[model samples]
Target chain A: MEVKGFWHWVRHTLRLFALYGKMDTLGLMRSMGMLLTMMLSDTVLNIAAVMGMLLLAERFGGIGNWSKYQVLFLLGYGGLVDGIINVFFGYNVAFISRRLGRGQFDHTLIQPQPIVVSLLTEGFNPAFGLPSLLPGTVLLGIALPHLVLPQIAGWWFLFAINMVASVAVVLAFQFAFGSLAFRAPRATEEISSSTMHLLMQLKSFPLDGLGAVLTGSLLTAVPVGGVAWLPCRALLGMGGGVTSYWLTPLLSMVLALVAVVTFWKGLQYYGRVGSQRYSNFGHRN
Target chain B: MAVMSAAGFMGDNALFLIDYLLRFLRVILFFALWRLILHGKGAINGYTLSTTLTYTLISEVFREVMECRTWLESGFWDGSVSMRYLRPMSVFAQYAAEWSGGVAFRLLTFSIPLLLLSSLMGVNPLPASPQAGILFLASLLLAVFVGLGIEYLFSGLAIAFRTHPWIFNRMRAAIGEILSGALLPFAFMPLGLGKIFSYLPFAGQASTPLSIYVGQADSPRLMALQLFWGVVLWLIAGRLWEKNKEKVVAYGG
Candidate 1:
């Protein structure tokens, strides 16, 4: 929280991270009970949240044209995206509206780092963040056994790229929504969280069965489809043909560009008006 | 609390607006998921699109008002639970009243309007028979107590947590979403698992009432089971409250 000069701040942050890393390693010795409790609880929550679709896939042999493994893969992708968000951003940074609404943006303004960099890094929680991925990574492993390799030799490489692009699409969208906090901090503060909830809730839907209009709207307007459906489609060879096979990464790149423009525009507005909201909540140290 | 909450919806709904929008999107997604699964089939294992739509509608409405989430236990988190102890009122009763009032308002404003609109659009949400309708109401009433009891356990168990009580709340909510059949009808469950979950306490919350509404559980046994879980959950909830009441008072907001 100290507003040191730029180089000093960078060095301090590195030192703090090294210390934090050591503490995270020693977390077992320091708070074994709490650590275990969190890990166990996170696993259960992650499984339960995705259990309904999985049960449907298991019992009914998957929804629509999707095979059980395909649905599992989609769930795996969503889980990994969520895991990535948590490990890097967690809810605090991922749901940036809260910090903005609470006038914590002022603290970011004071940091030697750029506001965007601060927003991106402030909520790193690697120690606790990795637990939610247990179910997802396990699911991915389960789905890997059923993988249908495309003729392309770079299938794994392509999937990895899609995964990275999907994360960019999600985080960038969150940033765009969170930027609204600059103008009307309270009103726009929860936009990111709400949209995140919307995305998470709808991301795994087997959207292949819907009509073009509905599917197209879901893919573009909301883009929950972009988060999982299209990516899974690409990976599963359901992208209609080669030209469409890379649709997910393409959509993600377009989304990332749109997100950047929206965010910087919001930042300019934020710089112009600043926040009028007041806060008594102690600054996070 | 119920009346005040009903009034508060009018008083301030800025927070709820976004939540409601998300719920609407979830409902649409639920519909789309079903559309995919049931396409060209007309019906699967006795569930038609209409029935499933009705189920989705009722599930969204009832859970929105009646089902409890982490925020329901905010009194504990914000230390307002201790203040309830200062009053002559029973904390459980107070929560029930608050929840009931909100439920009544939502059933009137949100549920009724939505049902009417959906009905006009050819998805009838009403019960198959008048008796079924009456029983659905009765089952729902039982669910109020069952849900409150469950919320009590959720809050009371986390009464001693030093950090991240919300994790327990999230876990409980996740468990409820699946087991309560609020996410989907237990009909899609493996035959054995469906029957077993139908007997579990969580089923008493969403599954039983919806079952009654759909005329799938007209048997006196389901009603009897709902009654059974109602009493058992409250008793356990009562025990948890007694053990944790002191812990609640230990921290005063």
Candidate 2:
């Protein structure tokens, strides 16, 4: 009875925390603003680019043996997935790294809460979703009918795999950045900015378009390619076999396991190395 | 006397040119170190290393040349504008002169070296045409004006929001960076989506000019649309400034 009660409380607390997280005012406002701006920018540029290219493609009679709609369909779904990630999971790695490096992790240690739960829930960046992505979601819904339903369901499953992968890989990135903060806090800031910049700039394009060598490296090594492209191919009912459909999620699970293990190892190193408390104005602990 | 005056003018021009060249060179070196991490590998949203870096270098030059610092907090707290308004010169004109000086300093120092490096890296800077060059310069100048105007106007939010102006400013900056085509090239998105982005001022700031120079835009008609949006944003900024002028506090520093 005691153990069952404890389990029930845990479940109740998780639900309550998630509910409160959704109510975060500042985060939501900021998200709204971001969504508005990104939507405006993305909407205009994407339309102009696709239509312009399609017109050209029509004249030239399609490049790479794909129809204009096929490419549009590819981009539309790719963008939908991209938008979801940017809205929800974008902050996870950066926030974790910043907190970990600052030894702000200690603050959470004193609380009677789970460390991971606190890290995810402590500060909400609602602005990631409200105005910006809300509209983008509408745009995405409009684009959705263009995709077949069963494939869309499959894509959702892939999205689930991608989310797990995101947590894993992003945790790795955070651990790597945070670990550097022990030696140099400012360095993490630089890394964060550049990584964010690179992801924003690079992730939208078709990975395969860059050709085989680069795509192969990204797929096997970094693995950002798997998040969208793998699922996208599955959704399109293309060359991706049943094996390919399962491949990304399987990889995601393995990567998550590896990342957690790596992070644990990194934590052990941190204990041994013992980070210094950076002081202001030449002050010392 | 006329010949001597002409020689003097030429000397001043040369000095200004040299200053600009030197600043451009320094910035280029800084950027080269910054971008060295990428090592020109990997594609960003369909832009190759060559195209991406070239676009980046151009945009960086525009940003550095046009940046106006302390437009928000200073205007609210320091009474800096009070002094400027009392003077004979128009505040806008004075600021424009400062912008010109900075631009001059950047062109000679940073831009030339970056141009050289990009050329060596096989990155063609822009399509070679007098008309294109003129259009590009004009659009960039308009962007600076629009950007500064917007910054200054929003900086006034410091009066109302108090102590949290930095938050708003950062938010604004982040949104602007993404919207402005600084984050990703505008060319690579879906057609419907790209249409929406082009309507926003961000594309007008970076993407449109770059696209025009790169021959990515369909026609001069699109360039005209870019100009139209720049004007509209400027007008919007002016309106916002007028609406918020009364909220300005004369807090002493």
Candidate 3:
């Protein structure tokens, strides 16, 4: 009587998990491990960057206005959020779409549950978990004591929001690539490859290094800057003297939700167009 | 009669081959021009757009000339070689000959177009010193062997696991891009990471050759280090191949 719709979705989501058996469970662990290793490498890479910053500090005292601790703090904050997104969303949907293009996707689709959940559940890369989470956790520990408790809590909230939004952006990008399967099967592979190459170039460095205009554009249009830079700035009190002081966890949540909505809408379009198309290896125009 | 016809054709139609080669060069030139314009002159990852454009062109040539016809795993996964069992030639010898033939064909065919493109674009040729040139040449050959060995190692997975392992291969490549300094120059990466990367086999394929050419190696000692890894990988690949040969699942066509 109270709420029928809410319970139904919860049941569907729970039922989705119930479909997995032993092999899928192993795949999931493998995916987790793989992701974890990659994240650990990333974190180690970030730590290496921190040392570079320390060297820069030795030479010039500081970069722009931020101290070495501030930079490391930002690096830690960004690394953690970045790891979470890659571990969860980086491989799941993107890898699924590629498999679908290769006809391996039929294996997951034939299952009795929701195809997406089965996909997400089945391809668990064990490396995925530690490679992402460890860097964030370690950096967070190192950076935590430097900030005020409330500020640290606020930063943590921002980190969660950033993770969600980044994952959504990646999902949207994947959906866009997935939609290509309807017209051109090879296009999905091409698009995903090119996008990964471009993404590494985009986010490997801080948005601040890109300067004001690009940073502003990133925050407003792409929202990558918002996910890491703007939130980090707000947490550390780096820039936007007036606006930075007021940037709250609530604002980050709102932006992240908006991005998710955009991504979901894109995914719906992919699902609608994709299921209707017929592609066999031998037949072509 | 076949040998006579081949000699006659080569003697009679050198101009036709040149004409076709010129047409192909023109098409590649136009495509590269379009890509360079669209990328915006902005530098990302220490490569100025111009340098990146040049790198892309060179890499394309290298990729075309050096990449094997099939990824090493293909022999295991696709059942392409069941026919080879019926053939008179040794399977290993057949593959090796084809690999060399394909690479040689690509290098011979692609060299002219690549040279013209580089000259037209005013991209400088890699280091001019005799010693450096010799070392660079050595590194490139070593890179090919190491790359081949890695390919075999990855391909061996298909024999053992009964899966294509393409995802693992891609992951390996991504890891290499970072650790091997193929995408971003190793020197530009954080120094601690660079030291760690210097020890990895992935860099021995792409970065070591490129670095030797670009004069990025610390000394001749570093060149020797790369050669050491190449040998190590070659040995490992041989072991992996021996192990995998027993498990080769030969399905009937």
Error of 1 at A180 (Å): 4.3
Query: Mind giving the per-residue lDDT tens digits that candidate 2 earns over A1-285?
Result: 234356765785677446645655444456555445544544443343234333423333333433444445544444444444444444343445454544554565576655555545444334443333343345446546655534344567665665455434444443443444434443342344443333333333344444476566555545555545555555556545666666656666665666566556656666676545432210001
* Residue B4 Cα positional deviation in candidate 1, in Å, after optimal superposition: 3.8
TM-score of every candidate's chain A: 0.86, 0.67, 0.62
Docking class of 3: incorrect
Give the Cα error of residue A61 in candidate 3, in Å: 9.7
Q: Give me candidate 2's interface root-mean-square deviation.
A: 13.7
Tens-place lDDT digits, model 3, residues B50-166: 444444444445653223333333453456666665689645445655666555554555655575667565565445356766886787777777666666666556556544445
lDDT of 2 at A24: 51
For B1-253, candidate 2 gives per-residue lDDT tens digits of 2233224333312323432433343334323422442343475345555565666667665665434332344333445656666778745455555555545655555666667676664556765366767777766666665566556555645444333344455555655655666534565454445568777766666677665554455436655766676566667656655676566555543
Please tell me which predicted candidate would have the highest TM-score against the true structure.
Answer: 1
Give candidates' CA RMSD values in order: 3.6, 11.0, 10.3
Candidate 2 chain A least-lDDT 10 residues: A276-285
Interface RMSD of the predictions, in order shown?
Answer: 3.1, 13.7, 13.1
Poorest lDDT segment (10 consecutive residues) of candidate 3 chain A? A276-285
In terms of TM-score, which candidate is stronger, 1 or 3? 1
The CAPRI category of model 2 is incorrect
Question: Per TM-score, what order, best first?
Answer: 1, 3, 2
Off by over 4 Å in 3: A1-4, A18-92, A103-132, A146-155, A200-202, A211-227, A239-285, B1-138, B153-175, B183-203, B216-232, B249-253
